[model samples]
Target: MRSRLLFYWISSLLVSGCTRSGSPPALSFSGGLVVAQIVTDSLQLVDPTRQRRIPLVRYFPQPGRGSAHKLKVALLNHAYHGKNTDYKFLADNLVAHGYYVISIQHELPGDEPIAMTENLYQARYPNWERGVQTIRFVLQELAQRQPQLDWQHVLLMGHSNGGDMVMLLAQEHPELRQVQQLISFDNRRVPFPRRPYPRVLSLRSIDQFADAGVLPTPAEQTQFGIELVQLPTTIHNDMWDGATEAQKQQMNAAVSHFIEKK
Candidate 1:
């Protein structure tokens, strides 16, 4: 299924003449073990009757032996049917900063297309729920492999539909309090969580097709402590891998600042 998805995406890109941006260079970690490998990893979670596996791209980073720093995980979800490589720049940046990043692809064939309008958008709630299940499965797998993994500092991030999924997970699952921050890139449909926990940081682009739906009212920002950054004259798609050097740098700066905030 994973191979088929990749093939379908590649073929679609070719036929559409959609040129992909270059991936970031692998991060170098001295005196640290940075294992950067892409593998088709899966587990049967939804149905045990059949061997249905949920595929995920895992980026595992382990500190050098005897290192005191605890490992942190970041799960990044791509937009609806969007290429996972769209998140490559952010993922590489996270890994370079010593985070274990996993970029998830959540679209399957025959699923309802996501839309910015509320009437056309409510139909895709189930898809977002399924994405939540996938994240749970991955987290379960990680726990089994590394029992001591730090959940307190986990980061959840996504773009478009993926950003919606991040919002859903943070709201529905109280166990995710360990998720230190939730960062979204131009997610249009879902409203930000109203809680004050698991700090919310959203980045908005000047989307021509759909509303950004990222900004909180000044009152809401003050009350919930939401952090919003609206990029100047930036396209929504440029927030991901297709970003220019300046855009990428801006994204990095925003994210770095968010992470470093006390």
Candidate 2:
């Protein structure tokens, strides 16, 4: 009789504990547009700066009652078939912290590789230009879709080739000059922008075999006023999706601090 009573008591306790296990947090909003198809046909060739149709993914904070100031963030993925899901953790955390993240899917199916030639810039110019135009289209859409967002708090972040693209955008787009913060994850092709412009935070990963290119040297960082954070045992791809939870959280904290910094 006592054994039967004890078993029932334990089972009840187990059920009670199971019921208290936390439910998953709500997911953020994700959506985008294909610029070329969405825009009017008259705006096609007539527009001097044109690009192939591209998709943009917006990961917005879950709807709630709060007073946190919202910022718009643009996250560009790496080159050659890279998808925006690569930066899922980064985007989700940013959303949780009151920022709207726009992930640009710059590469389309059947697109040719970025050409190589005598001029280094010429080799990658087309690819980078396409990314910039995609971002511009999304920004125009956001102006209408999210008027309450604080445009002054814009942040641009990218990984690998996407990181190179962000640097190129900073260099070529005068309209983006007002963009306040830039973050790159293991991009090697382009150097950081000129000194005293938008502040920069570069997260570098070390993998001897990859030859991921030169990040700003410490002296360069000091001269250009950029911040460089190195991950000693990290690999290139792991900097994005493959990163461990601890690694992701470390990056999230660093990014949050930089964004919140005055």
Candidate 3:
């Protein structure tokens, strides 16, 4: 009986140690690329059907360039193919403006280039829950990897379907109290839990999803503590690209101001 008890104690210790050591260290970026130093391991979620793994890239700001303090931001790509182009541009700009940008390649539809709105809404190929889980997984992974990152300073920015994703994530994962601010571009539909966090920014264009209608009615907006910004001449695609230098400056200013206020 004594020996059995000793063995059980040892086993418990081993289990606890493994649990503490299992998590991977946070990824870091140094030079121009600001590439992630550690490769992300597959993250498992509650819904098995939604389990799909994708790579997340990190773009760290050049040290001592813009802001002395490091700000970690997560940029979620629109549903479509999860290509890194749009995010790459955004990350580069953010990095230039003094931010550590981590952009994720969300699960695409059947490994092909397709619109995420149609696929996610239609339930044609890729599952929407999978994308949702991916965002949660990445956020947790970053928290583990970068202890230096200010949890309260973290921001979530998305475009199109990606915009919708930011709202969904903020609503679902209240436990991730670190995410302080959220910004979405050209997103039409606003889900329940209308108010998420203290600061929310939505930028809509005249074309594409905006053509459908403005979501989160003024009453909902008042309840949610959201700030809505509408650009007159911009379109859905313009939200991603095709913005002139003046427009880009305006966007940069808006985002920078939001971060500063938060």
Model 2, 19-119: lDDT tens per residue?
11343433332222111111101111112346466556566533443344555554546545577657667765666555667777777778778765576
Stronger candidate by lDDT (1 vs 2): 1
- The residue ranges of model 2 lying beyond 4 angstroms of the native Cα positions read 1-51, 115-120, 208-214
Query: What would the TM-score be for candidate 2 when compared with the true structure?
Result: 0.73
TM-score of each: 0.75, 0.73, 0.67
Winner on lDDT between 1 and 3 is: 1
- Ranked by lDDT from best down, the candidates are 1, 2, 3
Tell me the tens digit of each residue's lDDT in model 1 across 95-133: 556566766666655556655556644677877887787
Error of 3 at 202 (Å): 0.7
Worst 10 residues of 1 by lDDT: 1-10
All candidates in order of TM-score, best leading: 1, 2, 3
Each prediction's RMSD over C-alphas, in Å, is: 9.8, 13.9, 17.3
lDDT of 3 at 261: 66
Per-residue CA lDDT of model 3 for 60-172, tens digit only, reads 54333333465656555563544544544455455544465676666545754434454244543233445567777776666677777665566788887676667667777
RMSD of 2: 13.9
Count of residue pairs whose backbone atoms collide, per candidate: 0, 0, 1
